[model samples]
Target: MANARKKKRADIPARDRILEAATRLFTQRPFDEISAEDIAREAGVAHGLTFHYFGSKAKLYEEISQAAADRLDRIHLQATLAGSAPEKLRSFLVAHMEEVHRRRVDYVFHSRGGGTAAIQDIWERSRSHGIRLVLGFYGVTAPSLELAVATRAWLGYFDELVLAWVQGQITNKAAIVEMAFRLFPVAVANAELLGEKNLPSV
Candidate 1:
């Protein structure tokens, strides 16, 4: 029995196994509810191996988020820049929601305890990238702090609206997309920072 277990463990590389297990487990459950032991068990590795490779459960969770983010970046980076700013943003958002749904890892708002920082850091990085994407979509050739800040604020609001959509609190994706298209003017009116030229019209 012991020899059989050892042979099975030798079949796959430990790091890959741990990462695969982490991806599966993390995608299925909220971050805090799962333990390193659980991932180790699922990966068919010794419990200590998870620690040996990832250093901590939080680090393991971060690895999963990093993987998902990288994949999302690769898949949507160009598609989000394809059309007029309004058309681009709408396409980008639809792609984002579909990716999130496929990954089954919308655990950002659900993370608790020690994983909060990891999840939030990923969120901020993702948000900043998104703001830049909108700028690019609009052909904002020269960036300014005021416009950037206004756009960042808009992304925050847009994300919350999407979250509501995700939770079945709001079922209208078109409404979300429509409101998102209107956010630039709203941001301009509220912030008075971005000039008419700096904002998207449609």
Candidate 2:
């Protein structure tokens, strides 16, 4: 069965096969742990094909990381465009969990601050989008510095719960989302204490 799959992968266009194989390997291990040769073997292509398509291993990893971030961004944008605030927040959380589970090891690595600067930058950008989405959900378009700081801190708490859930320590996703829904207003209230006021509810 594995051999048949390998042969089938070999039939894919060389560049795409390499990308697919690299993505699979990346989901299983960090960038520094995977060599171009490993990708070439997994893709059933000449070792030089990865270089031909991407120039270097770092470049290939960058493309894969960027691609994953782009996908999550699309999911986030779609959620924003088509639902009530609670529905959008729930939808985004569920979709985010699905993506994290699909790439569990990769998500865990980056969640634990285990990546190069470039890779971490991509992770940060994704988190920034998430923070903005949560702010939008709460009807905050122009956040003050206090509100922004509070929101970022709230997301850090949210991220920790998500990381635990993905790592199998927490089992009930609904509970996590509900916790976020409940805690968000409190977080904003704290921001109010620091001088921002009249924050809307989730």
Candidate 3:
């Protein structure tokens, strides 16, 4: 078993191993508490390799943050276009909740990323993608300012709901998803009231 484990580790690429180790450490502790040497030791690679592969610890952390954001974007992009807008929204939410739950540690870490600009940018970009998806469900590509603001506000609410769930403040995923879905029409209605016009049926 030991020999097989060693062989399996050897077969894995060094850069990937380092990244895996770094992710585990970063998620477990503040980024400032982890060092390149610590990542190398955890990855069972030479210390210099950490810098060689990633340039610096901060760069490595940024890469991890970007990767997490990209995964969420891809998942949102996979929402089917064939369903009714409400059905599509529910599918997006289900995909989102499952992905977040599967990587709750990473999700929580990047979601609250210690006030770093790079991480904040990543989070904002992911949120923007989500807003686009929600708007697309209503077939609105050129939303008015009021509509855009309303949609973003709704996204913010959903963000807090997921954050609460991941932090264990909320135990019912279905309830959170349904709540968000139920509020969608209200968001659109408010936008319409605010002078946005002709939003496609949801």
Candidate 4:
């Protein structure tokens, strides 16, 4: 039984080795430039095993993107569950920026053109989950149409803000956090006006 378990554990490293090689290759060059053969050579695995494990390069890219998105989702969920709207928002921004900094390579890959359709879908879903959590924390519940519009606008704003920060247009993380903090009250007020049906008492 112990030998069997050891054998299973040994296989996990090969999978991770492929992923690591792919990640490094993707970061160093354009997605089109990196071939499965390159990845197999870098990972020290048979080329066939790359296809066997990940099906295709596109699929492997999707898996990497999904993993990163999942990490971000977990961070946001943890922050939300820890405190009130204001606190949650602060923690969420901090955690998000920190994650981006830590996983900058993955961020770069997603920001680039390497993402597969499945990866794009997972990212969109994760974003929606974050926005919904924020709305819920603020006790906001508008009509479905209005909520959709507002959420879209808010997400666009959030995306722009993060992109600017990532591109070095914004240097101070604390300043960005402060700006986010200031925006929360206005958002909450707007929610109060638009979402009368589900306003929680202060």
Specify the highest-TM-score model's number.
3
Worst 10 residues of 3 by lDDT: 106-115
Question: What order do candidates take by lDDT, descending?
Answer: 3, 2, 1, 4
What value does the lDDT take at residue 81 in candidate 3? Answer: 56
Task: In angstroms, give how far residue 139 of model 1 lies from its true place.
Answer: 1.1
lDDT (Cα atoms) of all candidates against the true structure: 0.72, 0.83, 0.83, 0.72
Q: If the candidates were sorted by their TM-score against the true structure, best first, what order would they fall in?
A: 3, 2, 1, 4
lDDT of 4 by residue, 11-81 (tens): 76778989988877765665667899999998878899899999999888777767778878898888778
Give the worst 10-residue stretch by lDDT in candidate 2.
Answer: 193-202
What is the alpha-carbon RMSD of candidate 3 to the true structure?
Answer: 2.2
For each candidate, give its TM-score against the true structure.
0.81, 0.85, 0.87, 0.75
lDDT by residue for model 3 over 1-202, one digit each (tens)?
9999989998999999999999788767767778888999999999999999998887888898888779888888786556888788999988898888777766676667564687788789888778877898878887778888888888778878999998899999999999998988888788887788776676
Q: Compute the lDDT for candidate 2.
A: 0.83
Error of 3 at 48 (Å): 2.5
lDDT of 3 at 194: 79
User: What's the CA error at residue 59 for candidate 1, in Å?
Assistant: 0.9
Instruction: Report how far residue 114 has shifted in candidate 3, in Å.
Output: 2.1
What TM-score would candidate 1 get against the native? 0.81
Alpha-carbon deviation at 40 in model 2, angstroms: 0.6
